[model samples]
Target chain A: MELDGNSSRGKTIASGVIPFVFVIILMLYIFGPGSDLLDLGIPLPEITIEKIDFVDSEIQATVRNTGPISVEVVMADVNDRIQPAAVEPDKSLERFETALVRIPFEWNAGEPYTIGITIDDGTRFEKEIDAAAPALDFSLDLVVFFAIIGTYVGVIPIMIGLLWLPFIKKISRKKYHFFLALTAGLLLFLAIDSIEEAIDVSDENLAGSFNGTLLVVTIVILSFLVLYYAGEKLVKQANSSKITKHVAIALMISIGIGLHNFGEGLAIGASVGLGSIAFSTFLIVGFALHNTTEGIAIAAPMSRGKLMIGKLVAMGLIAGTPAIFGAWLGGFSYSPFSTVIFLSIGAGAIFQVILVLVKWIKEQDTVLSSGAVVSGFATGISIMYLTSILV
Target chain B: MMILVLSVIVGLSVIAILPVMSEAQLKQKTFVTHSGSVIQTTGEIIDPLYTVSSVEFDPEEFLRNFEYGRISVSESGQTIRDYTIIAEDDKIQEISPGVFFNIWSFNGTVPGPTIRATEGDLVRINFINNGSKEHTMHFHGIHPAEMDGVFESVGSGGGQFVYEFEAGPVGVHPYHCHVMPLEEHIVHGLYGVFIVDPKEERPPADEMVMVLNGFDTDFDTENNFYAANTIPFYYQHHPIQINTDELIRIYVVNMVEFDPINNFHLHGNLYKYYPTGTDLIPSFYTDMITLSQTERGIMEFEYKFPGKYLFHAHKVEFSEKGWVGMFLVNDNHEKNNQEIENGT
Candidate 1:
């Protein structure tokens, strides 16, 4: 990578001196007069309140030491009153270590309270709770609330997208392959989106010791192989006609979309649990708009088949109900590991469905690169991108 | 060329900025060495050697000291010792460099004052709980049921109780808070070494107390730092100064909670190990000894030569996490005497 003799010489000198500089620093630190440097008294002891939970007659706050030096919580006060507070384990928190400071105060529900924590250096950190309410727990009311969210974001929107089935069925035979290609495009977008989301979640929340990226990659490959094997076995067993194969493809597409919607449900539910997002009409509308197009992707595959009313309802349920379960899991116990697992599996399933759809499209009499098929693919991706903005 | 000139400039600048950068980084490193075995923390760290200097509590002073209390002859001709222990929870101590822990201590010190007495002496303890929470000192030696420090919980805010008992079961024992959720009280530094010396005193030399302890700084049910006498690496920084070929007796008490067991290993020497100091005769001769929570023993050893020797927890994790120390052995008695004669 050397450009010229001067540049290469410069590079060599730079690399050599870096180690030389490091050794000198090390020697100075160990044997030199270290007291002056140690007594430099650099700024330290940064702390922050990570979370606050109001238990029965108690306000437990998770506080983290974000500074270079360790800090101790010397005292705690609530509403200008010195409260009997016990910092779990001990009051001193090493750098980045979190301590739960529990204060025993008889606080009224719906009342406002301010908590102040004073460290050993006399520096105090104050956090105000707008309203004192019991921390979120599994309850009947919470279940209904999450179900309503699932219905709006997952079930109802998907069912509305399924209304495209009648119009899709009435189309000419020449346009049948175009709709199938569009379905493939939709599944492809979903696969990439879910995998991208999984990677982000893994990076942010998974433990450093665990190879989270590798875990996602492995899970995706395993799920893809498993789906492909299962599909191949079933098709060979049935010795299925074109109609039966098309029906299987449609079912697979529904299941794939269902998994993607489940991950979507998880995000919505976890946001509520973390209190990062509040329940709002606008958010629900945004989610509903984002997911409405999934139904069309699911319906496009079934257009060639003579689907019964019962089967149509069953497909919709298969493409929707998992979201309800996902919301329940996420709202109650939202773990990033589980979120990563589900998203990776959904991405894998979508990828396998896309593979099946592409093979089916190639079997058609028309060229795979025809204008209709190419435009259908482009249009499908464009629709997903446009709707994704709402989310 | 431009590249050569730029490279030289950069190198010179790096060298020029070296001292400032190293000073900033040295404070953040837990310990610095040539091989880069440094724990890079977020910010500046206080010097471990000087950390206790800022605080009133000194681990070296705590070592080898015994609380004999108010000695009195009772009407029954028995020796009576009256000791008043004020339990407080608000005291903050630097357990390590840059790490401060709110220690629930007796008389404002972790491991309290090493309460020592001859066997069969009448030890009367005036217990006062001045903390915000309830606390009761439970001694591990033989005592009456009423004086057990349990059953009758001492309330907070100037609560008082008198524990009168005959010191028996000659051994080194741990005395700690006996409140319900006892681990919570003990882990927060509510424990101390209780020594009931045998009436027939053993051969004395240089005696010191080494209370093996740990602090779970993050409340994560696991210990983040471990130490002897509450301060991690204190003995290592200021190695315990001892004369060569002199008998050294250590009353080692293990008060680490969460972990099942802890151990002590000495470098370059084996000690006469007394199991709990209960028996006069030495039980085993070994370089290492393991003790569970609250289990303590007496160790007697003498350094044959003059040099620095290391003593630490045999459990590698414990030692690596700060339960290590050193003994600075001196063979300079003749030199010191010569200097004294010369008056230099």
Candidate 2:
């Protein structure tokens, strides 16, 4: 069923794409990139050679500071030899930051070299790795691996939200106004947040570059225009455009939230890479609460008509699952510039979703008390702001 | 913007022409004096020739530096020093970090070791040919014709010879295997420091030896790794520690081949540079000094502040290619250690 004025076309595409996107994001957030859990203000000495490269007789290793506080690397060894290696910026590395340390030598190809590092705190880390391993270490702990796969728990609530569509449809018109206002509140927060995160990554080409910032802004504006046009086309094709428009706007909201969740995933992943277990735990809880509200936002937009479990599930997955993927990438591989790209596009699309809701709210002439909107917005901000304190 | 563009272009052209001013151009180019003044014409010029006579017409055999399976070190408190060196190929385990370069060194060390002496000392170096090529120890000091290692070839098939000379004028000098294709022999890592103290005795200071050499990693005839003490980024990463307000004496020799010149520039401090190490008096008090190939001298400096300072080649290309290092002067352990830990 192509989207050529077909009734079931949008349903088919939304259901399949939303679930896949949702599951992928959840899985990524849980296991993609992460550090350890620990207490507040406690510094620990830990390091990992996140990547290794041997070229031109120099062995360059990218090391992640998997610790709570700043630590100085006093010495490095290869195969028990007191090899001469130098760390850039004078070797004092902070938590979560990475640095390049290189050693020059004619290496014995095809041989495993164990790179050992000694930090000022007297803690030592040694890992045996080949010279040409890919940047990410995909090795996962058996127990933690199954636990991360369990992030599929996120999909259950999405399924439940889809099933809640029938009862949602029976709500009085005045109650629907509050739900719409609440969804808007949630999305407004996300649009701003997503935009900021997209620009936070450091890179040679993107860091503080006027052109790079312009590129992000351009992508955001273009994303909004593209989604608005496609959404407009979909609404015009159906005889029963009211319900279809609601469903279409709901999917748009989900997609936008998906992008926002990806930014959150990066934050969680970066915290995990830093080996701050307490921070990661707090972040996961905060995001999980945020994700719960997102599911309602996805469903509230579509409660105007009879929404099947399949459609609600599709909407739920579309909106809630991107966080997982964001987390994984943030943990294993994160670049502030790259993260910004996703965030900017998401922000623009989500803004378009808000515009659709605003126009719909005005067209229907529903008496939405400004107090409901103000209270709803206050609740949305307060929930997220309060949850942030747990970390 | 126009000035910036012009300066960039000019900089590029100068760097592009750096390889042109080599020994190969010495015979063809006219000498240009400072400030574009004093242009001298080439008339029916006669090149002057000079020679010095020595005590003996022939040389005597000496002891090998090391016995079988035992390392040999110079005897202390002796005016007459007997030394031995074998020309052989060895690998510097990690020349930079994990980068290794093959070297033809004395005692498996690059730039070898600093051989020190008093001016009146009778120095004898018994040279052994144990490698795959003919080699000789050419000292950049006064010696008789028969003792000059440049003209005499010690065979690789276990050939042995002796070089004996009275250590003349007090100065810092370089010694290397002076065989055919001299640039290759020197660049391939056959070099060391030879320092002779003056008769009046130099001031007591914390002395260190540095041999400035570079590696042709890709062998494109351009140095890829330029360094003092033969390790690229060695000094930059692992800075030499010095006490605040203490004199630092460095006998630095530039044995870098393929490059026409190398220099030493100190950040945050000035040094009394003694060119050729001939006199106790200083020629200039500057933060930087340049040296041609095999040119070496003693430099003295003291840092007043406790900070990590950069010591590098003023030649930007050389410094960029890793001929740079840092010096950390420690006045307080807690303060300096924290700075080092923070990577500042």
Candidate 3:
């Protein structure tokens, strides 16, 4: 460990905080599977429309309500021609419940019909009825819907980013080179993941023209240039202190991650709106676990620099808050185009961070350890790859 | 030079994807038919103009606990039974959560309270209009046009009008605002049931009153919202409990305007329909019953099984729009204890 006297307090505090965090995560992983504690009711109930289906000329909506508020369902139409609807749990809905409210109506198959229902608590719900034309539910119930979506998308990235501060405070000088390679490896995998997602989103455009391929190539190169210039600007902006330079780079990296996370948030939110609950849960767990490595990437730049608790918090918010905002927007009003644009920005920014890492290794007087660097990169890649597979 | 080339390519790609992508998305959102066929639409497409539905009655359970501001008192030395109903306005009550309806109520609610008494009771209705307009309450039972609340016999806003009449035949009928240009007056939430029980004691049973009405929220001739009670979807959420094998007497009155007639259909149960309270014998044993505007009746049915019985208009349009409700028939208490007795 090589911490100067000036920053020993930060190192000491971070050391204490991270171990406590690890112990809690470890305890949950070990005991949670067998515990009944998670079954306890959520005090505040929230509900969202997951999917709307029209089967056999009847309209039905699948709603997910988390927490403990009771809800009732009824359908009202313009002509008042709704067939009687069957509401499950015909009484009060318990918290942490999902219900499929079947609103059957006798209508012309192609005729446009709309069902509006107002709940007793003064909240109103209006849904357009299109047979098999699934639209995301727009109602008062969706406000809490977006909040939950934000939680699923943001928690993982923010938690993982914040986790690195304590452990990376004072890596031994001997192991610093190894950790740098490891950080590069983690970031490289992120850049790849981001670009792959961006490409996947743009796949819809592949049939029309060569635009998709062009978009991929252009963003990857553009992000590298942007980040390269950003690094140079950080150097020029430095106040002759190593700490200042490191902090600037770290902040820039956080900004890059924030952009990428926002794109990820959009994907998760849209998935929920599309009523793919199983897929949404899978993405949440996979992304959160994968995000566990981002901490190393952000911390690597500041390995030998002064780090304040407040500064680390600022980094976390800069990196993580965008995910929340992104998920909320995604769940509420996400379009496919927004997905491609933001993810492109992310892919570009991360590519920039990887270049900064290479520059760091070359800045040294002696040649970097190639063997340690190669193995560290492999280890880092395998860790992230394995996390993705396992999750 | 390479960066410049890349920037130009990115810019061109963005422009290419924006229009094509957005158009596809709009098409995707609008293509809602079950056939899953994409139908192209444009910005110039206008939605079909719709009319406001008739008087929208809130859910039945919404007014279940409410009395039509019952101010009627049986006084000692008064041969004329005095009934006081305030023709009040501007009381914004929540029929559903956060959904407020402006009701021009007699007393404090739409379909002002049901005034019950024996036949031949002198029904002296004191109509006070605390409203901003003229108001009147006309008895559906036999009454002269002067006491009918029509013509010049109207209570001005912030004034009072006293109507004295002898209750005629024993029957279930609706008393409503009979002010000329009748549709607007009655639909303004000024109507109620006046049940005059037969002099010979009728068979005792659990009873409820259902007033079928619709609302023209936009004041257009079309009735957009409809309900059995004043609040829509009330009985669906908070179901009316009925014990199995219990006779349920229902006094249903159709005060709905815009539509000529409305039907009351009960799912999983059938009832004896009486077009008028005058008949001791029911008109028929049917699952569905229909009543015309201002036509009131007394109906009875007994649920034989334990389950949720849906009651709504047979006309699918009227029932689904806002006139839907449920009666949850519970198992008899004594029946549940039989299993304990058997120790099975």
Candidate 4:
């Protein structure tokens, strides 16, 4: 009830002003000139050149900020002449952070060269190489290294899974449909994993301005639509032959699994390039274990077709060769944006393969809600989850 | 019921205002100036309010102070002034908070000491190069070719040279290190203002020197931060205190490199512009003027009201990157001076 109108209005005004004034005073005390009293004396900048290597025609010098303050590499010089250089990851190195500074200059072997780096503060630091020799590029040893990792992680695991094909031939129609459902579940997991990996790469390694997440989403959608339309057209044209339809589905599954394996290889190669992780025997074995399930997904759809040995090897090659190329690209010139784009495509392809398998399963006498199909799907996802823990 | 309803509305409004206020607090931590321009805090941890101590170079002290050197009268009734300037490249100065820059300086400071002399005076500069690199004092006004700092390069490691010339052209000019790769010397802070006053002095008020400059911290041939008198947003937090209705003359020099042009704008007032200060008569009574690299002029204006005013780069990018400042026009100069002297 309204007792005194004027006093109520005055009280309302006072209540409103009280919180507002209190907030203003609190903010001013925290952020205003009063905070200037917290001045720690100025920090001095110190930079050290950690290591220098001559790779091809370029000289890559690893620089570290040893000071309390951050340092930015502003210029690179060769024998006092300013030469354009590229700073990888970033030019600004925070305290204790290291960056790779690559300067392209053609120098003769066994010649003394001075590589100078000018920091943000106008100070030039120089590192002298007494004798310049070309360091290791994409050598035979590195190729062997990538091949061995790819064989363990990509090829051998898929070959081992293909070994199940002989045993799968004796299964009845109902049990075969269950395997198809299991393949779909495995591919669904791979699709989700690829998308997750793409998102992580975009967020961590790429610059924010590149719109990495949006790029991944768009590429995934585009790749999915294109592959779905093509797969449907192929299936419709081969409607007369059940064997052709089965073979076509098996090929699509192999290609989709191939793209996912490529993304895995990229992770392996990039980790080595960034020097954040080592290529230990345990890591290779873990990756090999994680990818063995991918092989079964490819083999499940091919059970109905009369599979020739050559056709099986061709499918295996199509799914396994991309990991090799991914390893080479990621090891040599690993850019996060490219990884995001490729992984997004892999996710889209895998999603489309899952849709095709579902359609094929529906074409059979098996119901989509059958208990066998449901259990098979669960087991498929469970296998991938268990193996991924090793990775 | 009305009081309760009103109180409920007030409570809701406070909830709405809290977020925006806290956002402003976050922006303050990011070094956004009062004029709403973001100073370059990306990849930096600079303290926006940090000013160099008195032992180091003070932009406020460098503003109005002038070096007249040792003065005497010649036998022909002419003025004689002798100045000694030591050029050293080994000095490290904290241009911005947490940002230490290698400054090639004259007498240990960037935009060096303002060398002032009257017109027709025989000005002798005893130059010494104490840097590790070649440096020479090159003045912008009339002088003999032999006395020019170019071609006669002063060697590093304690090189000496004498530049003797009669000071002419009543205006403000820049003197810098005229070494090869000239930009390297200029951008690293090897430059200063040289003021040639007329024999018959004009009515003087409060005069100061402002070097509009920028630093390319990323070595990308583009400036990462812009500033007035070396430190960005300095005058904004600590506004240049001045008396109301007083004539304030500012000698502005643009020493920004890698930038095609830079401009200045004053808020709340207009000034009589003297292009290069070459003429006694005013050129334009305007609030804004564009400057090319090394282009300078004299600005004279009087604030009629007692309040705060902004002076900053008209180019929004430059101001956003740190070239903004403020002027506090007060009626009581003595009390304000006392407060400043007490370091409040």
TM-scores vs. true structure, each candidate = 0.50, 0.41, 0.43, 0.50
CA lDDT scores, all candidates in order: 0.80, 0.66, 0.66, 0.80
Candidate 2 Cα lDDT to native: 0.66
Top candidate, metric DockQ:
3
Better lDDT candidate (2, 3): 3
Local distance difference test, candidate 1: 0.80
Candidate 4 lDDT by residue in tens digits, A1-391: 4669888998999998999999999888877985975457977676766556776666777777877788887656666544445666567889878787766667777677878776767666777766676553678988888877777888888888887887777898777877888888888888999999999988764544456788888999999999999988878777766548877888898888888878877877766654446568888888777777777777887777786678777888788878887887777667676788889999999999999999889988679899778888888888888888887
Error of 2 at B127 (Å): 39
Residue range A357-377, candidate 3, lDDT tens digits:
767766754255577677777
The alpha-carbon lDDT assigned to residue A122 of candidate 1 equals 43
In DockQ, how does model 2 score against the reference complex? 0.02
All candidates' chain B TM-scores are: 0.84, 0.73, 0.75, 0.83
Q: Model 4: which residue pairs collide? A: A74-B218, A74-B219
Residues B69-148, model 2: lDDT tens digits? 22233476436777778778654444543344567877566666567777877787777888788988888888898887
Q: What is the C-alpha RMSD of each candidate to the true structure, in Å?
A: 22.4, 26.5, 24.3, 23.1
Count of clashes, each model: 2, 36, 32, 2
> Candidate 1 chain B — worst ten consecutive residues by lDDT sum?
B44-53
